[model samples]
Target: MNDEGAVTGRRGTRITSGSGRGLRGAGEAAKNAWRRGTGNRMVRRTGLVATMIVVAVGGIFAGLLVAGDTQADVGPFAARFSLTPSVSGDTDVQIPPLGSLGLDSHDGPAHLTVRLDTLDQDRTFALASDANGLAAASQTAAADLRHGVILLVERSIVAGLLGSLLLSALVFRNWRRVLASLGIAAVTLTATGAAAAITFKPSSIEEPTYNGLLANAPAVIGDARRIADQFSEYRDQLQRMVNNISKVYSTFSSLPVYEASPDTIRVLHVSDLHLNPAAWAVISAVVKQYDIDVVVDTGDINDWGSQLESSFADSIGSLDVPYVYVRGNHDSAVTAAAVAAEPNAVVLDNQSVTVAGLRIAGIGDPRFTPDKEADRKGGSVPEQLNASGSQLAATIAAAGTPVDIALVHDPASAGPLNGTVPLVLAGHRHAREVSFMPPVLERPETRLMVGGSTGGAGLRGLEGEEPTPLEMSVLYLDRTPALQAYDEITVGGSGTAEVTIRRHLAAGDAPGEPASPAPSAPDVESASPDPGTQASPLTSRPGVTTSSPRGN
Candidate 1:
């Protein structure tokens, strides 16, 4: 039978052969596409599983890293998420993880040279080819792990998004085409991911650290007192060392004069006067010997200033002049508050007071101490003391008050701004002594001085049983005292030395406001440095001699 364009071999059937071949070709093409799609879907699904594992692991690790980086009181500015390196090769040195270890400040003023050695290519290639390609995979894993943030932002983002789309498309495939679409999509994604894994590199960056610090509070008060005592000693020896006139020794400035005056004033001081009974005795004798005017006892007057029966407080009360004060690290803030509440002590913190014709302001260093009862393990990280300085400067600016003397307890806070103060008095670094950093010595707008301790030296009972308080100085300024002969006194000493105040006033001598009397040379009870003579700052006072950093 034949019909139109078709010819057939059977009697009852008429077929069109021209269109049959075309239909067959079209069916074959559609089947090919179906197979391809199924293969890609499977590949895409596998890649998605691998990516899910990668992301899950990365997230878990990232969380742990972030948690560990935060301090109880501070933050890791750069290490919001750090990569701590684990050792694999050499035992010679500790290789800090890249971008994790921050630039340290101990090297001085946040400056240093850095040297680095990264992986070599031959080794990298070997790592890429070994162990059934597992080593290559391992290397890629390590790189991705180390550069987790980078991978997360780059390849990971693409891989995740693409895999999700592919998986979605495969799931929606027609009734009989599910497996085919999943298989094809999966193959495409796997190939893309492997390529992305093989070649990823991180960019290097250098971060810089700067200096800043706040003034000492407890110390300035102590220095105020010390200067008074030393002035007395200087008065006693004035006649012997002078090449000049009649009143060779006459200590003038009194703590009261400084406290009562209203003018721009300058002060220099130190603190943590863990004065022992013996030391107090010497200090008392020194006070009476010089007839000092003004003095400030920056806390820790006794080893335990808070002990109900404290000789330090009694000694302080016995002293003749007006003295300012604040608590020490060892002293309880509550006790200090109580003391300040009374009329006996000033206990200045975040307070401003006029002194020696100058407006001197103070803020006690609130050292971040760990509460043992709470078993608080972490504390604030070491930040450049300047951060506090900036805050203080802001306070000063807001109050619109100018200061001449600054006091701090520890040397660690004497960052560059610390130098900006006319005189910064501190006591903790019994070693750094009196360093003179000029306002443009090595830098501009900066000058510093490390006042040695007043409680003499040796390990005191605080940590171990021995004695190390401080041995310090007194300052003198003439003219602000109410009377020409107003005198103040401090008494205490180590039996070996007794402080004696000897004054010979000239007719016109106005001993009223002066701390050190006019033109008198001085003598010292102990010419030899304290036992930690090796650690004494006076021995290393900037102009006195030269010493290596480690030497002191």
Candidate 2:
């Protein structure tokens, strides 16, 4: 009986142990499966995040394409760019920045004209001079723009949908989620648009009118002439943009190339207008083409700083960029007042202003011509320049802040400022010249730059036996706030009003030194060897290259 009981117990123990081993193996297998499944889900989630990022970035690119094709209605103008299939079915498409402008006439309805000059074709038509006329033009332009944007959208969307479908089928093995993913992207984009709408503000630029100025004019034609004089800058820009579209495209390669540096600043230096209306057109073109940050006028804005010449203020006021003006010997109190009145103009004489993170200080010329008389009749130009320079230098010192640039009209005036500032820019000489002053006993080298007559020396340029060519300077600075180089541009002298660019390097700056290293005062010199100095047809030069009239 005892033997039988022991054998039975052993058999029961073996059965229980086998059952426990099987349960343990099953649990371990289940745990391994769970881990594999979790890893797969995590990978899917990561892919979704990546897709979201790609969609967002792609959406931004699409938005830019739409914006580039669309043009918002400014008060008097409507612009739109279009690319459509030609009737000939040729793929060689030349889509220019084409647009139209409206001009309102007295008592007559406003007229809308087509901008066909973009195709090298000149066609002009008239429209009514009324709000309805402008509205009609705006609607037309907007329709074309919308059509262009829609075409782009259709192409992008169709391609994206097809790609998404294929990717879904191949990756997830589920086609329905393709639509679901698209819906999610669309919702995200919609939310972004809603946020933008909530924060958008209407532009404050209003249509300019001259009702008061015309009211007091002597005759309708005379007033019209006066109005044209004041509004020529805007007209020139618009007309040139339309008619010269081909030229712009051809010369596109000549345009300034900008690098991605927040510290670098581009300056357009123009001076010695001497009441040349065409100067505005040239300066405006350079400003827009080069993406200039600020315009520095070292004085001599008018031939004689008289009240009659004050009308030139209209041109100065019309500039869309910041205008920093200093009084030249030819300027008077009335001239200064005219500049000060312009909302866009800043009178920098005996004052300083910070622009694009750089401190700029300017001093007015010593001589002021209230009437149409010259102030340098008896006193020497040099003496007057010295006096003004001394006073300005003293003022800057008292301020106890170092100025990056000092602006004056006379190059001689720049001498006193040597070692006090990094760069000194002047323009009274009516010829372009650059000089590098070596460091003196305790001061650093100062770079002096002079701009030629932006107006080609005004009427005097045409009167003299010879005329000066229209010239201007574009200054380039690096992240070190150190002068890198400059381009001296000359436009139209004897033949076609072609543009010529000459590049010059800073005198002492290494050929290609890194701007991040410790900076020292840079030396300056004309990029080219001195084409032996000659007397400028319009003004006496203090040893600088001369040019001839630019008749554009």
Q: Which lDDT values do the candidates have, in the order given?
A: 0.39, 0.58
Give the residue spans of candidate 2 off by over 4 A: 1-263, 369-380, 507-552
**TM-score of each model, paired residue for residue:** 0.36, 0.47
TM value for model 1: 0.36
Model 2, range 258-298, lDDT digits (tens) per residue?
33255557788988888876677777767776677888889
Where is model 1 poorest over a 10-residue stretch in terms of lDDT?
A: 538-547
Q: Which candidate leads in lDDT?
A: 2
